[model samples]
Target: MSRTVAMVIMGAFTLYFLIPIWWLLVAGSKDTGSILTTNPLWFADFQLFQNIGDLFAYRDGVYLEWLRNSVLYAGVGGAVATLLAGMCGYALAKYRFRGREMIFNVVLGGVLVPATALALPLFLIFSEVQLTNTFWAVFLPSIVSPFGVYLTRIFAASSVSDELLEAARLDGAGEVRTFFTVSIRLMAPALITVFLFQFVTIWNNFFLPLIMLRDESLFPVTYGLYAWNTQLNQLPELRSLVLIGALVSIVPLIVAFLSLQRFWRSGLAAGAVK
Candidate 1:
């Protein structure tokens, strides 16, 4: 395509994606009556602050609890998942081990299997183990990301050199020390990518938490908002809470993406090299 045509196409796609966010931003700032009556793209009464205050103070500030739960699940879980994937991927890349190809193939297969497909089986097993409706039910499952492992393996193979590992070893660095100092350093960008991916996945996760957690205190933001949405008729006041809550929920994801964008660029470049 011509440059002009490509630019136009890109602009169109960008607008398509951004329009909803724009609408959400506009909608969240308006009162419930104006929201139902006004044009979605336009604003009326400025009630964003009021909505936010109400959002935070609603139902004994359960929204804040839900936010905290999401952050814990996403932030801590993502970091651990990223580290584990890095180690596993690095091992697969560097070591000549038995069943290496088979293991990798199995992991690749796992990438194809959607998480929703496994949720039922996981719930059944967790139920049998008597661990359902607890924090562990959602958190334990969120830490495993097959795609993260796949990406890390590709990054390790391309970015981390055998020469560097050998040099570290010759300098009397132990396996773990060398890995942390040399390999993980080189793999920082890729690891960040894995972390952000896992973080977003866990943050936006709904069904897993929905099925696993019966307690409102344990509900993540997504599930909590969904519950509020279901009660829109009974608790019409919750409409404002839901809208404002959604806007707030997305803030972290946006901040995270923007903050880590530089790492992503470097990581993509590294991944592209080999």
Candidate 2:
């Protein structure tokens, strides 16, 4: 009875979350007329392709620009963040230095600081340096992920053994060379884990972009969708476009997670064993 109840509860939660995603699909396939008249959960005519066509054509293909910007910000930012975090984490784990624990504690403290709280200050700082409304405003901040650092630290401590470092040293491998060749290869799973986490975070980021960017051309998909949503009151046509845009924005993230899912699972399993 207990197991049955637990399974049923889990299924209910899954359905609860999935229903909104299902509605986005159904809504995107619908014209405004069908959206107002037909059942919300049921499929309308298969106009998904038409909706996409209209979406790209609208506002001189602004949606595509938003998608491109998001890809740039998330992809490059995630990669850089992953590398920095991995290097810093490896250093913290492998080396005994003064203030190492303090640095670790500071990273932990950063995890507790909400990103939203920093938005206004970051904007002001960027504005002072004339970086606001530019790609750097969004991209620079996204690369600093405290949680990624935290994950890399934990993973490095357990997965990377000191004996291996000693062996590498004995073989006359310089520290930088050893880190790149041996340590990084050993830390592949952790690095992938950090990359995916930072990728998703950067991809889904809204508030930072919303604050820093004023130009429509620089908007990421999340902020772009929000702009469309706000303008829907004046431009009723944007309602359907927003729905379709929401669906479109979700695809890359889903693809990313699906492609790297095995790495995530294996990384967690490796952590558990270590």
Candidate 3:
């Protein structure tokens, strides 16, 4: 039947996506010698802990530094981006102000423009201001998420009721007070979604850091791994380290998703009921 065909297609797509992760898991479990010699899709040995220790110990624990940078960029940037997006979206949805539609339209246009396209101009602007090669070069840009604003606006327009705002206002609550104590709770799911999206985007960002940061210590994990990848010819031992670092880098993202998925499911259910 059609339902059977749908399930088959879904299974196919699932395997297609999961096969690489499985390979990475299998490969990360093996010693460097076994990786090329053994079956890539299955475990060769239980060397996962050993590989992790080697990865952490290499270069006096520079991998840990890169991991910390990634956490700082993604965690702080995602949180700030989510807060800004929520406030902008909530204002657009609730308040009737002049130029609001124009501003929303501008944000929509920004959503259409790819981040890659802005890198060059941003580089030039940052260079002029002498901000390149610093953490701000990446972190400042990461905090501006046009898509987050657009998504939050759409969610707020429907999910947040005007009556609730009226009640809050009548209760002697100020605008900022109402938003933090009232509207923010109602929009938790959307904000979390925005945070996850921005987090992943900032975490995986490579080109901007490659272009901006000349210092190795400032490199995020993605850029640091790429730097190692490029030097594989010089330091062949880095091959195993790069693989292990990559596998380790994704752990935070997985953790974030697993922790916040409940909010997403509840949001979906609430939307369905409405």
Winning candidate number (TM-score): 1
lDDT for each residue of candidate 1 in 1-274, tens digit (9 for 90 to 100): 6999999999999999999888888889988878888988988888888889989998789999999999999999999899899998998899898999999999999999988999999999999999999989998998888888888899999888899889999999999998898999988999998898899999999889878999999999999999999999897877877889999999999999999999978886776675
lDDT of 2 by residue, 200-258 (tens): 99999999988888999999999999998998779888888999999999999899989
Write model 3 residue lDDT over 53-153, tens digit each, in one string.
99999989999999999999999999999999999999999999999999999999999999889999999999999999999999999999998888788
- Evaluated against the true structure, the overall lDDT of model 1 is 0.91
Ranking by TM-score: 1, 2, 3
Query: Could you tell me which 10 consecutive residues in candidate 2 have the lowest summed lDDT?
Result: 265-274
lDDT of each: 0.91, 0.91, 0.91
TM-score of each: 0.97, 0.96, 0.96
The C-alpha RMSD of each candidate to the native structure, in angstroms, is: 1.1, 1.4, 1.7
Note the residue pairs that clash in candidate 1: none
The alpha-carbon deviation from the true structure for residue 85 of candidate 2, after best TM-score superposition, in angstroms, is 0.6
> Which sections of candidate 2 miss by over 4 Å?
269-274
